[model samples]
Target: MGWLQSLFSPLKKLWFRLHSAPKKRRGIYILYEDVKSCPYEDVHVLWSILVESHTLRTKV
Candidate 1:
């Protein structure tokens, strides 16, 4: 089980990168709202990236 985790650890970073915000903008950010604790940012980078990507696609 531990070996499996190690093998997939790098994927986490890649996933975050693929889902993170663009390097040129700041209006887009991932917001994480957790009632269990407090509203905070969790995937800001990822959210921004995704939103920008979608916007670009829609424009096409």
Candidate 2:
């Protein structure tokens, strides 16, 4: 009975650590190629619009 408790104590600690650890957060990143009509400026504008739209949608 004592040996069983000792083994389970470590297993219980391992399970607790796995559930309580913080997870890394990540964001979406987009890469675009520069063209005649769609240069870096246009690309960034589109990106901002998309991000803002997503933010608004999520807030509602």
- Please provide, for model 1 over 9-44, each residue's C-alpha lDDT reduced to its tens digit, 9 standing for 90 to 100: 999999999999867534433232322244445555
Q: Which regions of candidate 2 deviate over 4 angstroms?
A: 1-39
Q: State the displacement of the C-alpha of residue 57, model 2, in Å, after optimal TM-score superposition.
A: 0.9
**What would the TM-scores of all predictions be?**
0.37, 0.41
> lDDT per prediction?
0.65, 0.70
* Candidate that would win on TM-score: 2
The number of the candidate with the highest lDDT is 2
Score residue 51 of candidate 1 by CA lDDT.
72
Candidate 2 residue pairs that clash? none
Q: List the residue pairs that clash in candidate 1.
A: 19-46, 20-45, 20-46, 21-45, 30-44
- Judged by lDDT against the true structure, how good is candidate 2? 0.70
